[model samples]
Target: MEADKYVVVMNSEEQYSLWPADRAVPAGWAVQTEPNNKEDCLDYINRHWTDMTPASLRKG
Candidate 1:
């Protein structure tokens, strides 16, 4: 089987998720960067996405 491209996505709540690179990102989700392989996407998320709380609920 061929490898699939992937994308790292994020939501208003600051949560991170993975999506198929060939597919359209769902509403309320934004692409964090250009499409990459699964491993790259996971690495990006690990480097970022430190806060899991929703922006409205996070305290300074």
Candidate 2:
């Protein structure tokens, strides 16, 4: 089969909530961004995940 292509951070689309960097992303995964709207919580990640990422981060 082909590889996965994205990661979904929530059980459902409704849970795309974003907490503060310290509270949300573990330690090193923090990327600064300003939320213009509610959609920022749901990040569209690439499929090329590596060990550098937190285990909690999904692989699609």
lDDT scores of the candidates, listed in order: 0.87, 0.34
What is candidate 1's CA lDDT for residue 29? 97
Report the lDDT tens digits of candidate 2 across residue range 5-42.
Answer: 22233222222224443334434334334432323334
| Structural similarity to truth (TM-score) of each candidate | 0.83, 0.22
TM-score of model 1 (CA atoms): 0.83
How many times do residue backbones clash in model 2? 2
For candidate 1, lDDT tens digit of each residue in 1-60?
544898899988888998898888999999997888889999999989787777778954
Model 2 Cα shift for residue 51 (angstroms): 16
Error of 1 at 19 (Å): 0.5
Clashes per candidate (backbone, < 3 Å): 0, 2
